[model samples]
Target: MQWTKLLCNYRELQLVGTLNGGQSFRWTYNKDTDEWIGVFSKTAWKLRQKDDYLEYQVLGSLLPEFSGNNTQIKNGNAKTCEESIFKSLLEKYFRLDVNLGSYYKEWSAKDELFKSACQQFYGIRMLNQEPVENLFSFICSQNNHISRISSMVEKLCTHYGEEICHHEGITYYAFPEVEKLSEAKVADCICLMSLNHLKALPVDTHVYQIAAQNYLPHLRGKKNVTEKMYAEIGDHFRLLYGDLAGWAHTVLFCADLKKFQSTDHKKEADEGVKAKKKRRQ
Candidate 1:
């Protein structure tokens, strides 16, 4: 496998936050190599980042190549065709066309809390995931945490999704298609998050707590989120953050997660150490 350079900045795309910050659960971080391994669009990918760009390695067998009209192309340049298709898929998956910095500035200007969150959490962008995979994975997300959700998603893929490849003694599977997930459950807000409906806010316990304390104070003492309250919470965020409310909601959600707290603290500490070293010099 050859590593292809993907034009991206860490500020525009933080692999850790984007992949593990609760949007999709398939990606696993290899701490030793500082690489992310995951499957998307029926292909397994290995990704790592540098200062101003990303490096990707396509793993396993390449899927059948098809043109815009879904016709298989038989040509001598099949390898080139696969690379072209994969590159385009990567761009679309990350929604690389959207100017995240501009949106961050715009969102920060509108909301004070979100502005603070932007300072701590940058480069957390919404992924444009496949609808069938997104729908089924998020269905597993309901009433679950990231670890368990990931396990469930893995099981689904292992049982139903096509086998992609084996690497480092572990096997990767493509996310099962819609037909394979006929009996699977469903969830709404996260499905919207994956589908890039920026205004759709999926309210869960954490979001409800945040809303009760900051946005909707009336529900402070409530035990659970009722159906009516769910819509109201979604409406509140949409009204506050405009069309990309869901994107803004993600920043806030990530900020509130305990999982990211230690990572942020360690990063800040590392930066502090680097600054001190500069001062000593």
Candidate 2:
């Protein structure tokens, strides 16, 4: 069993509308223990630890079976062989590498408020997400809150993914293929929390919300926004920041911290109204 913490960095996972939209899963490497952990299935999965090496069970049987037993694996201690399938997948499915500093500089230079938001919130960029998976995952995100989004993603992985085991207690599931979802009874898998809602939902909530708020005036449509519009917004960010689409969404959500402020304001407003009524009496 090779023991190296294989970091799975996918930006699509962090897209604004992704069911798995968060960046904590992208973490610093542990060189000493060679173990890494990521949040999937609404829980964290730590990589298996072994002497002389660390191994991340590539979630599905995306790779061929290794030839050795535990004894041979231990004695050999050779670096785990590269899985070309995974390499091709890493390339084909995700947009991995990015220059975050450049993107930040450019975006901040364009807007002072954006610069202040980054300084206040310590914004980070997104990387390595597959577009098709992003589309489906975001479809699962419509009108739903984060907790439910996480559960929905877990269900999709557990139900459709090919599973693989690592340590005695741990296992991982890969994201299912597009054809699997496209052919699926979309309603059976997703619910309104109904799956019918899923068919009509777009992939990026930031795009949807922003367009709804008319933040981007160039886009115009009837009553409901279109998936193409949301994708176009994501594409615009991708063009401006390369792979910072996920990062941009995070920053936007963070800037909207005023939603909390609005809640506080409502409480104060109610209290003031009550005080005025008491004095009037």
lDDT of each: 0.79, 0.44
Identify the runs in model 2 with alpha carbons over 4 angstroms from their true place: 1-36, 39-61, 65-96, 120-123, 166-168, 183-250, 254-281
Per residue, candidate 1 scores C-alpha lDDT tens digits across 41-152 of 7877889987678888777643654434222221222266677887888899988898899989988898888898776688888888888878877778878999999999
User: Which residue pairs does candidate 1 place in steric collision?
Assistant: none
lDDT of 2 by residue, 128-239 (tens): 3444444565566567665666668767877986664443455556567677787423331232122222112223445456544534566645355565775666565555
Q: What TM-score would candidate 2 get against the native? A: 0.49
Give the candidate number with the greatest TM-score: 1
